[model samples]
Target chain A: MIRQFGLPEALAILSGVQATILLSLIAFVGGGVVGLAVALMRTSERTWLQRCAGFYIDFFQGTPLLMQLFLVFYGLPVLGYKVNPWIAVAIGFTLHASAFLGEIWRGSIQAVPRGQTEAAYALGLSYASRMRNVVLPQAMRISVAPTVGFMVQLIKGTSLAAIIGFVELSRAAQIIASATYKPLLAYGCAAIVYFVLCFPLSRLSMRLEKRFAVKT
Target chain B: MTYQFDFSVLLPYWEQLLRGCWLTILLSAISISAGLTIGILTALAKRSRFTTARIAAGTYVEIIRNTPFLVQVFFIFFGLPALGISFQPWSAAILALSLNCGAFSAEVIRGGIDAIARGQYEAGTALGLKPLQIFRHIVLKPALRIIFPALSGQFVLTLLTTSIVSSISAEELTSIAQSIDTLTFRSFEIYIVATILYLTMSFGFATLFKLIDRVYFSYPVK
Candidate 1:
């Protein structure tokens, strides 16, 4: 029996894997920054700000990421904003990733010893200085493991970006699969690529979990 | 920047939006309940005395965990049709959601069971309690308590995952919102409103879970 699928098609598909990686990175960095802000706001003293952040996190975290993508990708254009598909996907994912990451990071932040914050305060460090100099460094140790674990999720999440017309790995797989009528092979290859991308991060997360077990 | 928000466009379509919300809730409730049941079975199977049962369940969890749920839904909705399963969008959505939730729930429940002290099981045997009775009275209670937080967290995740059903043309809240957006040409307002409604639902679940935890656990939450 002759094999119909060739290396060239697989190579072409694999070459486009960078788009998925880019989506994941953009979502990771964008989500990380927004998530940190949300985490801080969640712990803020002001009631309204905390409530707002809490609501934002809850909204993104609660609803389906697919729905969020639909709402952002289709919903925004209807509202007269008329943004590009990439921007919509990025925004949708960033918001979705932010909620989960914010909660995770907040857990890490709260896990920091109260005495550390108290000591920093006693030393007359301003709030920003205390957070930057004394608290975040320690919190990062606690945050690293889970944060790395979440990167796997972000990478997988880029698959949703394809729904909004972004030709990422999953979407590209769909395109080639339909053109070639070998879904099992095409999708299988895509999954393997995703697995290959995510497996290393999973291992890294486990390593971090072991190395930083004390902080957590 | 004189963009005034007009919510009045949504007033005429409130009835449809409400129906969509109803569908969303119904779908979520069904998926979560069914997923929880399947999850328990799978969780137990994964840790069963027989290796084959354990491997079968373990494989189910791993495949579901690793693959994208969107792909799983497609396999059911589109792929199953090729095999003449003939599932409606709702049924397919429920199936996918249940499988996804079951995998996650199995892990949570397994963690709960694993966290149990070995001595506790020995003590049950020493008391002449049968395995079923021991599991029912001792293992089930503490495991539920331990896993409740994670289970609730998974439910929240499931709630969001249900939105993917829209891709199959299921008229859930997001689908309805899309229709409403097309009809009214008020995407920002409708989406903003839908966003708030979703937040309300999330808050509602959180509050309900907290109350249930208080009433059910009563003891200290570990």
Candidate 2:
């Protein structure tokens, strides 16, 4: 018996929201940590470190996130390393997010006036102290808006986890769309759900950009 | 812990991969052109004096922007069939990609328009230029040069998003790589080569855009 597209199916698809949010959290939290290190590496004095970090950012930014996910989920198995779908998706999303966030943060770091770093060095402040004290505080101001902007992107990015059969929001919608024979209703709800999730963040980022511009 | 890296296995599938890459280029080129045209219109709409025009354009940009491109693709590819208007995968992919790209470019172009100073418009008006002619000659002419970098970046992004079209079985590079991987079980090697192909495409597109920016918008070296 063919079923009608109804509230029940919409709710069923909506149930996947938790999974979507969870995956975004995993990617953002993990990517933020790794990305900070990458940002530091990119801005480091050592030529080799900066070049390696540059290559990493360029590579990740240049390729599609879909390819990166496939590489982790399918490619790793060929190297005889078994990865669960969760691990694979997390790894893939983290790597992709890190490259972008790293670059964003690197730009923010560079925006901090060189004189501040020089002053810190004159005060016998080491790299960690200089970053922790002088540069990062100012860079944080420059970073907040773009960082929030990237987070909005990161949330939307988790949707591609569906490509790995991870049963996220987009995949869940696809399943219902096929089963209920109502792709319009199902995917329509899916798009609305994403809008609800992303629109506010974009607004907040814009607001933060204005606020930060005045302060900086 | 022994892993034998094999780039040679992919050599045999070069012709197939090349065909896929060509299709990717074709899809991106069509969408970028279509998307930019739509982008320019919507950008003007968003800036229109009519409230309704502003609202409609704003909503269109928001819906497309906030949603994931993958969902947008599936919605058009599968959802429209039920509405009694159906499309082949390629057409559906193109439509969704264009709409998505157009929405983002709308924002870029709107920013470009907003960046133009009020004085420029007044200067044209004082010189007896009509509203339309002032915009065409003074406002948009300068705005395009400023937004070229952002638009080109978006163009490269559209190229990458083309990879997602493979989900609809559009036979792009990623899709071809998928089938080849299954046939050879060289998943790692196949995807690595595919990744490099994509990287090269991105770099090539960026370079082409740089050249275009130079030729079309070259201001006397300031």
Over the stretch A42-134, how does candidate 1's per-residue lDDT look in tens digits?
877799988998888767776667667767886666567878777888888888888889988888888899999999989999989988898
Q: Pick by DockQ: which candidate is best?
A: 2
lDDT of 2 by residue, A17-69 (tens): 98999999999888999999999999999999999999999999999999999
For B79-149, candidate 2 gives per-residue lDDT tens digits of 98888989988999899889989999999999999999999999999999999999887888789899999
lDDT of 2 at A70: 83
Clashing pairs in 2: none
lDDT of 1: 0.81
Docking class of 2: high
- DockQ for each of the predicted structures, in order? 0.37, 0.81
Which stretches in model 2 have alpha-carbon errors above 4 Å? none
Output the number of the TM-score-best candidate.
2
Score candidate 2 by TM-score against the native. Answer: 0.97
Docking class of 1: acceptable
Which regions of candidate 1 deviate over 4 angstroms?
A1-13, A45-49, A74-82, A214-216, B2-4, B80-86, B220-222
